[model samples]
Target: MVVCFVCGNMTAGSNVTQLFSRSQRTQQTPFFPFLEYHDPAPGASPMGDDWSVDACFVCDALLAQQWESFERGRMPIGKRLYWLKRPSGCEIRQPVSQIELEEILNEHSRGNLDDYSDDEGGKSPESKPQDPPDDTPRLICYSCGKSDKDCPSMCPVHCKPSYEQLRTGVPYYPTVLDTDKSPGSKVVCESITFLCIGCLPKFPPEWHAVQKDFLRQESTQSVLPRIPLPEVVSCYTCGTDVST
Candidate 1:
């Protein structure tokens, strides 16, 4: 299902279409189609094979206005576009490909910075600021626009109150009892293994709640109690004494 990247509104079969400029002469294409364009990369080209469109017509218009301000020199190119939903912050709201930015940097590196120099034969005041590396990862949520740093410690979806919570004074707490705590409970490890948040699969709604509870409990139990081990016991069969 194609949903608006900004508002999450259903876009399938909607008359609304976002026009993406291909070139000065070429006509802008209706990019709201679900069959070919949706969930494109951070800076995917509109005419490329991997061209994906996430914003709906509404967002596209809003972005266009922002880009107009950018063009008017009223906004810095490096400044984050307020209406664009993508965290990459590479969206220029224009047809200009990201390669153009790279070429500007390349020319400057070759001591040909004069190529982009202003009319006074110096660096152009209108020259855009360089963007960050394309591979830089965004730490924002896919569903909500909030950054991971801004999001709550628990998953937002799982934290939503359910009907049961509304009916009763106590809220429901879910646990994934079927999930194994440890592959081998007897096994001990010196260090913890970690998985990237991106690598983790989309967990079920209850799983998130369970995970939150588990973490809370683990935090509480992190300080091991001062219980003493029992005194050494003797084995009756072999008459061997063992320490517990």
Candidate 2:
């Protein structure tokens, strides 16, 4: 059994059954559309029955609901969080802690969240500032650099957890895309980006490419430097075969 990415529990009950059935609708189901890369090889065998993810049943259910809410404009898409029942049956929506959130925002705004997470643990003690209290004024949205209060009522997906994200968070994995490489090439982000369900397709489809370098562009942020590709053949850590 795979652990759910959001609630960190084994997906149980009807959630598992329904998710598995939906996956069966296609040989290789597209659960995370934004992360999709690597076109199927010429005459590659169709994928068999396999439905795997790290989200619990409850969290998956919430994600399904959020997709509908986003399409209908009933809720701010990826900008907000939703409540979920953990495996222990606790109902909650957990956001990044204020201190952690500040660190994330600062690092990402500097275009180096991935670098920081890679080379060190957050910021240095002297560099780290005190987190703002709950009542503090909001910063501009990371994607648009506009105040949600002043801007039109559009979904606000921040680079990191802002006050609004604390109220309406969702789980996401970090990834990078190579807009400059040959078709069907991309790289997983060295940094993690926790995103809400509705923001899955947030990136422009035209921008992704399968390439040797890792590239990324968020909302309106300028693209970061290209990262070198990882070794193919077999991942020494995960033992999964990787082909280029």
Candidate 3:
């Protein structure tokens, strides 16, 4: 039985003839009769009624190809079952042939493959080569350098010592640095530190919060307790100490 693609209804054979006639007459109009038609009842399968359904055979074939491609992957059994449910439409009177489907699939696949090949051809030298490693190491702040060891630091003004001091709790002055020194070389450096609390690129804001919380917890645990006094000694009148 042919299914009506538009309304997904089980159309009678007579209705199919009527629709075909209407479609032929309305060919010049902007509206496609198939898209406009809808089934009156919901959840009705279109297999029982024989009707000429309106559908783009090419589009249907492509959709089938897409489904087949995805099915080959490690999809869950439940998902595969769910996707197997056919559309609630009458069976297509003139469905797309396997030969036509194959032709369209090949054409599309070739175009896509060509596009991918072109993209790969346009890649930069760094992305293409997988051989010898570049020995150049990036210098970053001593505090932030532990995790992001290879990232270049914005600390051109201060050397490792100054950078360490600033991270340890010292307030940094941007204008006082003579030259920036690193694993590379020593050069005259301006000590301008613009630490953006909001625009941190390397570490996410949440990570910083987590790190701060950890540090606070560690500090609370590491604090030394004050020693208790054994006795109090005081003299009011003579200003001399007396043990009690």
Candidate 4:
């Protein structure tokens, strides 16, 4: 079994899409060409070193469809949102109210959405803005800077969320890269991102053929389509794998 870095879902090893840094890809799997740091996925900073990302079943298809675009120097990322069904209660994220969501969407559109909280300048608030209680920590996406988990108050992840993420509207989760038990794990805004769930992925008209192509991208042989496992979901929480 492997864990996907994008949506944090569990997948069988054979059904995964492994995106290696240029060097790693050339050395391990050369079936596909690799992209250099000079051009990373849209809105993401240059990947600094050799690293790899695992995409689960659904995310793999999404990537395969975009592989051609990547070759064209346009790497689209952090542009979609997915809802994970958590049957049991979630510990890290709380339901956000509609009003709070609007503030996150409309007001920040003109300015940098990722700039919602500027901590530098060491200035104090002129007046206490009407917000949820201060205990719940704040989380903003490094990509699109959209949805977040918070109490009517606040919430916190492995670490504090930051205000430096680029706005790509893609749901980014820093914790998704590692198991929740990994040390130094934290969910900072610069390391996380959330897109408005409203934006949907555009599936091609010949969707079934595309899905078949996706499942076989790594090899010519067809593999079973990967299904969502509600039993295991990486809660956008502190990057921990949560089993419902």
Off by over 4 Å in 3: 1-131, 140-170, 173-189, 192-244
Q: What lDDT score is found at residue 237 in candidate 3? A: 83
lDDT tens digits, residue span 132-208, model 1: 76753234333323444443332222223454434343332232222333332221131112112442243333333
Superposed by TM-score, candidate 1 places the C-alpha of residue 69 at a distance from the truth, in angstroms, of: 0.7
For each candidate in the order shown, give its overall lDDT on alpha carbons: 0.41, 0.37, 0.36, 0.39
- Report the CA-based lDDT of candidate 2 relative to the real structure: 0.37
In TM-score terms, candidate 4 sits at 0.21
TM-score of each: 0.26, 0.20, 0.24, 0.21
Evaluate residue 50 in candidate 2 and report its C-alpha lDDT on the 0 to 100 scale.
54
Candidate number achieving the greatest TM-score relative to the actual structure: 1
lDDT of 3 by residue, 200-241 (tens): 343221223334465578444466787775476566788777
TM-score of 3: 0.24
Q: What RMSD, rounded to one decimal, does every model reach?
A: 23.9, 34.7, 16.7, 35.3
Q: Which stretches of candidate 1 lie over 4 Å from their true place?
A: 12-14, 19-50, 74-76, 84-118, 122-244
Model 2: worst 10 consecutive residues (lDDT sum): 33-42
**Which 10-residue window in model 4 sums to the lowest lDDT?**
198-207
Better of 2 and 4 by TM-score: 4
